[model samples]
Structures are given as structure tokens and as C-alpha cells.
Target: MNCQPWLKTLVYKCINIEHSCLLCSELAEQHYPLCVACEHELPWLDEHCLRCALPLPMAGLICAQCSRRPPAFDQVIAPWHYGFPLDTLISRFKHNGQWPLGRLMAEMLGLQLHHRYLDDLARPDLLLPVPLARRRLRERGFNQAGMLGRWLSKALAIECDEQLLLRTRETPAQQSLNAQARQRNLRRAFALASAASLKGSHVAVVDDVLTTGATAQAVAQLLREAGARRVDVYCLARTAKPGQA
Candidate 1:
């Protein structure tokens, strides 16, 4: 039997152990690129909305926004709150092209999903990265969400189709807008490259963060309309509601 994969993993572990933790200068005690302490200190999401992953007072309840108008996506799986060094890492990876940082987060997210799948989270048939507008793609040099999807595809053995979704037009950044304005900004901003590929398929839309979730809703609606059986959102982090701590 081939031992290359095992050998590579062993070698990687040897090297990883010798490095320092990304968050702290401590030895990387964990098998990953972080020490146990640093990893534990990250802003892990605990109780959150069952539907949108929004931070809530308790677990297993849908947020008011989702209750008022249910999203097209069936569920959202995010592992962290958008805060602290986690947010800094994401911003650096997204804006400054710090790919290794992004990969580290994606690896962690993939591990979380793997455990969730063993429980009740339904494994999706297809991983679709929310496509970026052509102009933004050119300016950013790479699509961070696409990278996350591809990495997740490898880790979870899922089929990732980067070309399945297409951003037909550019919209203003969603960060500055509230949920309603964000929905308006994304109107007609996305399209599916091929509806046939999504027919009766369970799809997970991979993204970096779930803020207002306007983009996720828009894409999920389109996919559902095009015959997708179910669509879910997978992202690194979720932000709190407007007024909540």
C-alpha cells in the first residue's frame, strides 16, 4: 500500500509542532497551527439562531428577522462570532491576500462541519462559493469565498462548483448597509450559470462571513427557484444583531 499520504502527514506534524502559535508566540501544542490556549481563546460561537446562526440569548431559536421572513436557505453553519483576532485574521486574508491565514480558518471550519455531519447536519451534495463580481474579482486578485469552498471540498470530499453561480453585476459593499438596504443592493446581482446542475441537489453556499445575509438569501432563492432541493449557508463567522451585545 502507498504510504505517501501518511508520510506527508507525519512530516507536516513534525514541522507544525516546531512552529509558534499564530495567535500567541507559544509553541504550537495542538496538531494545528495554534496552541490549545490560543485556539480556546478565539471567539467561538455558542448559542445562536438555528436558522441564520445569529448570536442569540439561547440556542435553538430562530432570530426575529428569520421568523418575520424566513430565508431561502434552510440553515446556516458558522463556527465563530465576527470579533477579535478572528475578525482581524479574516480581514487580512480577504483584503491583504494573506492566504495561509484563510486556509487555517477554513481548515478549522471544515473540521467543525465534519463533526456536525456525524450528528444531524445533512451533508450537502454540492459546495457553491458565492460568486464575486467581475470587477471585484479583478481588483481583489482572488475570490476568498471560492478559496474557502475549494479547501472545504478537499477536506469534506464534497463536489465544489465555482462556476455554477455567477455574479451578473457589481453592488456596493454590504458592510455599510442594514439588512433591508443590503437586500436592495443585491437585487438582480447574481445568476446561475447552469440550472440543471442544481436540480434536486443539496447545495451549501460557502462564504467568508454571514452579516446581514442578504447575499446568501439572494443566491439561495435563485438556486431554489432553479430547482435545488435544499440550500444552506456555510461561513467562518456570524455577526451579532444590530443592537445586541
Candidate 2:
């Protein structure tokens, strides 16, 4: 089946019109959503905990926190730190309803996956977004994580099962809580939707940001419980310090 000519034209126009970085409002020089300046200025967290992707004082395989209590996901891949133009872009995407920004974030994330996590980027068996609660979904009109998951799946040629993970409860935002409190709040907040599709699969969980990583950890734990062989995290940004969580 072919899309109607008028509809196709409309879609093309929508994608082409003077696209600019959401933060700088400068013309984007590349196909990706962010402008060149914004892209170059992205705060990359190179020295981080390999397991959690949290910024660390020195290069190491694991951070003290992850050592004390390991995260559910085996590994994390984040393209940038949660700050400045990247944070502004994320805020616009989540709070201001800028849907296209999700795709852009996914593109940058895909690049990171290719460069940093080369072994895993070949393609996961499935890509799942950390599910949002019904109330939050209603308020936001979209799940930013789900949107990114779809885009990432397409880019990576992996299947995206938007319904594989379910948020069992709506917890308060982790931004206002300490690490311990964040973990407690997110406990029991997620579950797998089905065991059939999950059994023996390697899944990649997508999220727009990783703060305390409580939400991702919960989701990954549930996926593993449901029989997923492995679960890795792919987030657009990671929080820099402790208080940010």
C-alpha cells in the first residue's frame, strides 16, 4: 500500500522545515536533530562507572555505590550528561511536547551504542522502554522513553515491544529524593507484561534520562525475573552528581 501523495508531501514538509536545535534555536547542520554547536558542546561522561554510568573520580570498572549494591542491568550506555543544552532539549521533549526531539536523542544514543558498547550494539533480541504509569502517560500524552525505543529499534533493526514492560505503580519523581529513598520509592513499581516474549531474550531498556537509576534498575530486575537472559540500559543522559537524583 502506498501513502497518498498529499499525505506524503505533508510528512516531508513537516520534517524539512528549517529544523533547529531545541536549545539554541540555531539551524541544525546535520541530519540529527541537534545543531552542530549543541552537538559539539554535549557534556559527555567519559570517566564513569562501567556498570551504572555515573561520573567517577577516576577510571574504574565499578563505582563504590554499584560495588555496594549492583544495578540490575548488566551495563549502561549514555551519550551525554544531564545538563545544559542536552537537559534543555530533554525538558522540551518531555514537558513541552516536542516529540521529534525523542528521535534526535535516539540517534545520538544509537551512535554511542555503536562506539562505546560495540559488543552489544549488534542488536538486542528486543528493545523495551521503561514503562510509564497510566496517569503520567495521560498527562504527558506520550511516553518519551517509548518514543526513543521505537526510534532506536528502527535504527538498530531490532524489534521494539512497547508493551513488554509495565509500570505497576506511579511513584513520586526521583529528582526530589536521596539515592536510598529513590530506590525505595521505585521498588515494586515495575513488572514484565508477558513471559512468553521475554523468556531467554536479551533486551535493551530505553529511558530518556538516568538519575539515581532506580527506575531502570527496577525495570531491569523485573525483566530478568520474567526470564530475560540479559538486560542492558540505553539512556540519553546520566545525572552528574548525587544531589541531582
Candidate 3:
């Protein structure tokens, strides 16, 4: 049967408005859906660790914490600090079902990945999200990391493997714990689903934020144990402080 024209028109309008530029509430002028002003205001990270992507003070190549005890991931890239409007944006994206922000964040991250890793990001064999535990996933009705990973994979033209990793244990929220407590809470919280798909693959792990780097470290360690050749983290935001847990 032929569709009704009026209904089709209404659907089209909804789609157009939904995809409109969030910055200006109009059609986007660039590949990313943000207007220039909003794009400029984003807290882009600069002078961060080449390995950890932690914001670094002047005259230091690596943060003292990473120098003292390095994480398992080969590198991390977080384009923004998790503060101010970025924090609000993440809250909306995670708790209020603001999916388009995920796309915008992923686009920005893809641009940063291009500028930072250059050719290496272009050639990653797979993309994996830091998995959410099944209970949390059910409660939240979605996994924010998985949403970010899918968007990133599309932007970077990489294969996104949603099942590559699994959160095998549920832990208390990291916000409530100190660094040592957070580390202890997250121990063995993640596990590889199976080595068959990930064997000898270079995987880029995606997440919305890197706070203490504990969760990402655990996931990377599991990936390596499952025979992943290399694992790098791609996050939308990172906490500003070194000792936050």
C-alpha cells in the first residue's frame, strides 16, 4: 500500500529537527552537527600525556602518577575534561536519553584521534566499548560506553565489536571510593568474552570518560590476556585531577 503523504511529511520533519545542529538548533554547517560557537567552547585537551592522555602541567611529558605506575592500555585520548558544561552534557547523555550528544562527542573525539594518533587510529583492527555489567545495563536501559563506541566506529570507519568484552562483575560506583578503594573495587571486574574474534587484533576501546583510569586499565589487561595484539583507549572526557577516584 502507498504511504500517506502527510504522515510521511511529519516523519520527515521530525527526523530533520532531531538531526538539527544542537548548538544553533538549525541545520549543521559542518560534518559535525555543532555550530562553530559550541564547537569552540568544547574543553579540548591540550598538552596531555601521549600514553595516558591525562592533562599535564607545563614541562612534563608524563604525569607523575603514570610515571610511578603505568596503566595497562598503551595510550589514551580524551578530548575534554569532565567538568562544567561537559559534565552536564554527559549527565544528559547518560541519564536523560540524549543520544545525539553521543554523536557530537564521537565526532569531536574522531577529530582529536586524527590529530593525535594520525595514521595509527586509521588502522585499528577493531573497536570495543568498556562493557557495562548486565545488571547496570538493564537498569539504565542502555550502556553509554557502547553507544559512544558505535558512534566512534562509524566516524572512524572501524569495525565495532560489541561482544568483545564483558563486565563480569558489578561494583559500587567509583565516585564513592578513594583511589586505593576504587582500585580494589574494580579488580577483575571485566573479562574478555572470547579470544576467537579478538585474537591478534589491535583494538581501540571506547568510553565516555576516564576518571582514575582503573576501569580502562582492567579492560585493557583482559584484552591482552585474550590475545589482543594492542589496546588503546579513546574517551570523550577525562577527569582533571590526578588523585580523583
What are the lDDT scores of the predictions, listed in order?
Answer: 0.91, 0.81, 0.79
lDDT at 64, model 3: 80
What's the C-alpha lDDT at position 93 in model 3? 89
Best-performing candidate as measured by TM-score? 1
The parts of candidate 3 lying over 4 Å away from their true place are: 1-20, 24-28, 116-122, 195-197, 242-245
- Give the range of the ten consecutive residues with the poorest summed lDDT in model 2: 114-123
Score every model by TM-score.
0.91, 0.84, 0.84
Steric collisions counted per model: 0, 0, 0
Q: What lDDT tens digits, residue by residue, belong to model 2 across residues 1-245? A: 77699898999778776677765778875676577777778787777898988887677668878899888788888877887777888999999988777777888778777675466443578888888889989998989988898888878778888876788888887778898899899888887655446778888888989888888888888888888788888899888775642
Per-model C-alpha RMSD: 4.6, 6.0, 5.5
